[model samples]
Target: MPVPSAPGGAAGPATPPAPHITRRGLALAGLATAQFMVVLDSSIVNVALPSIRRGLDLTPAQLSWVVDGYLVAFAGLLLLGGRLADVFGRRAVLLGGLTAFAAASALCALAPNGPVLVGARIAQGAAGAVMAPAALSIVMTLFPDGPDRARALGVWGGVSGAGGIAGVLLGGVLSQTLGWPWIFVINVPVALAVGAVVLVSVRPFPAAGGSFDIAGAVTVTLAMAGLALGVVMGSDAGWTAPVTPAALVLGLAALAAFVALERRAARPLVPLRVLARPRLAVANTIMLLLGATAAGLFYFLPQYQQNVLGMSPLTTSLTQLPIALTITAGGLLAPRVAAVLGVRLALTTALAWLAVGLAWLARADPHARFLDGLLGPFLLIGAGLGTAFVYVTTLAVAGSAPGETGLVSGLVNTARQMGGAVGLAALVALATATGTPAGTGTPAGHQPNLTAAFLGAAALAATALLLSLTSALHHPAPTAASPLLPGQRTST
Candidate 1:
């Protein structure tokens, strides 16, 4: 009898078998853990904010820094971090980032004052920047096949969506029972465990050989920092103030210079060609708007629960559970919806839902009941946000060139972070200018300002809806035939 063909129809003698360990499974676990950690940090401190403010004697401006510091650093350095992951080994970058994040979390827990806490938060953001790209990139490498990759990405999305809501609930429980410091302290153990798993299980991929774009990184970081600082300060000081304008001008100039550098550099921090892609540009814009709305909602929801509804920290956390649960469900369903409806239609529907939710929220009054007024809107926002994220992420990275995925993902996230910073700043300013709190001890004039802020959030959601619609209506350019194997092109 003729010799039976070896597996995969090899004519020559079969090569020696590779290792038995399943690297893809290990990588997916590590990446999901990293993403969960990053997303958790975004909302973990929110429930603890009042405690932190009192403990640290933080002014409103300084309190904003606690959040802004982390956001600015994370957003500013993300592009650089992604580039480093590509140039270095992703595994090494991930390990280093986790270490840095753990160290920073310890510092935050031990912080003596507002400045120290702010500094630690900034360090945490920088650490997040380093890890996030590597985590996503590992997923890409682990699941090179399209269907498997989509499933992995869906799981990742679900983790991130669920993590945001989980953070608030977890923070409330930890802060009420343990203390605010426990929130930060809790991360250390988790990081250590995940780090060990990654070190043992993740197989390193070949690094992209290239020189680090230090100058480009510095300029972009400076640009983001300056712009964020300018916005934060402009909220307090009039935008026409010399310092505010100066910071804004300087930030714009630095950003323009970074763009020029990117176009010229052989190994650009962010390739100009990638940004020039229409689909990526539109998706990123939508991501920015969606991020703004999401961040604003998170920022204000607690205010509604505690200030208006007279809920305690624990009660407030429980109240948010509906939104969180819905978001998790929406994330799991988003991929299926996209496969059935196409990316554009799904995203448009999601955005429309978000707009409706925000509009309902804008109608909230001091007399509004939780079940009647708040629950439906919160659920709508959460579901819409989950679906929108799925579409935006898919479009942002679709058909990206080899080794550029990290950069693309980082840019998308950066836009998101920056949008949150800008949106919050604008909302704060509007709130400051609006009506006072009802039944103040002094007089009607002393009432708290909340109407404008909620209105601003509604406007943000409306803007996001418009952007999503525009994206859906825009026709995608024709592309070359896909190289996917026959029978693999069927929609999920």
Candidate 2:
């Protein structure tokens, strides 16, 4: 523990009181909880889709929107949210976002129609966009770079990784036992509780100095929203669908415009120069790949368990518990691994581990029991996800200026979100095209080839692994404030 400095060369205090230590712990818990809630909502409704459809009398298209709407809005507005936190102060933005998120959850629970539910979900996403980055920024503030930060991030990454699977499990129990509405209702209490904890425990961070870049924010949000919409529509309606092409075009144009605008803007939302830094750029790229694999795996695995392996929904949820737990365990291991290997090699090893897991999963026997085929691969994948999540995040935030931590946080979050949305769409398309045998039908009435999706996901991880290796050749491992075991060298 660090001691407080005394004035005028006097000796420093020996140690802080217990309450101070407790408050710091409370702040981290509060922030990690907030992050968990946001991540949980991303996939919580997946298991409840059928219940939601019956309750709202939704069309298939509208049902899809219930999930996609949240993703689109969340991915779209994250950068703006991070910029807002930098300009408006972390605590204020975090508190405001929590309030809005809670309100949105209530609206979702009380929604009477499909449109209302979809709109409410979008509101939830918008609130979450702001909530997540601010919460992470506060976490960065709480722990300075070193072992403390790595350990805290291990907790953060573990919770985050677990939330995706936990959503599936919790959604099933709540939807069956209580109702579909309970899933949304659950978040309200959790968000409010987190808000209260944050209010008491976290000290407010001063706002960053700069004028808000309205034009840059608008263009980037449009770019992201359009891209997300295009992918979702393409997945649903086919790539040739009119709206799909149109949305893609608009997204590309907006992205181009945003880049140009950022270069010229006096107060850009994201500084291009900062983004151009090799370590940050490499980290985000690898994160995008990892995110793609994680999202695609989570989306497809449940379906495979049900449609292929013949597991009940509840059973499938139970079986997935190991994956979530191992991911948390892997996160806990990341700091130690980085200590030995350095950040670059640690990330490369994690990607390679993920690729091996995904490849193993691709060949899983449909007729085999979970323990025989699925469990081994799941453990490997979960561990890889946990470790990579920490290492890549460490790379992204390592050398950022104090005032720009929020922006760096936003960029990393945006990369992962965008990757999840786009990669899932692509993987779905691949599975659809290749998973089915010609002129043959399966018992599940044409379930897409899930193994094919796993293979594609493995390919993505391999690509990331190769990229990390290539990057190692060109750039020495980043040494800025990154955690290393005592006496360990920064480079391999």
Q: Please tell me which predicted candidate would have the highest TM-score against the true structure.
A: 1
Q: Could you tell me how far off, in angstroms, the CA of residue 202 lies in candidate 1 after the best superposition?
A: 3.4
Off by over 4 Å in 1: 1-28, 143-155, 203-208, 240-242, 339-341, 397-409, 435-448, 471-473, 478-492
lDDT of 2 at 486: 38
Poorest stretch of ten by lDDT in candidate 2 = 1-10
Shift of residue 51 alpha carbon in model 2, Å:
5.5
lDDT of 1 at 284: 80
Q: Taking the tens digit of each residue's C-alpha lDDT, what string does model 1 give over 78-156?
A: 7677667768877788899999999999999999999999999999988988888777666665664567767887688
Q: What does candidate 2's lDDT look like per residue over 294-382, in tens digits?
A: 77787677667766787765676678777777776786677777778876788888888889999998898889688888888888888
Give TM per candidate. 0.85, 0.81
Q: Local error of candidate 2 at 61, Å?
A: 6.9
Give all candidates' CA lDDT scores.
0.70, 0.73
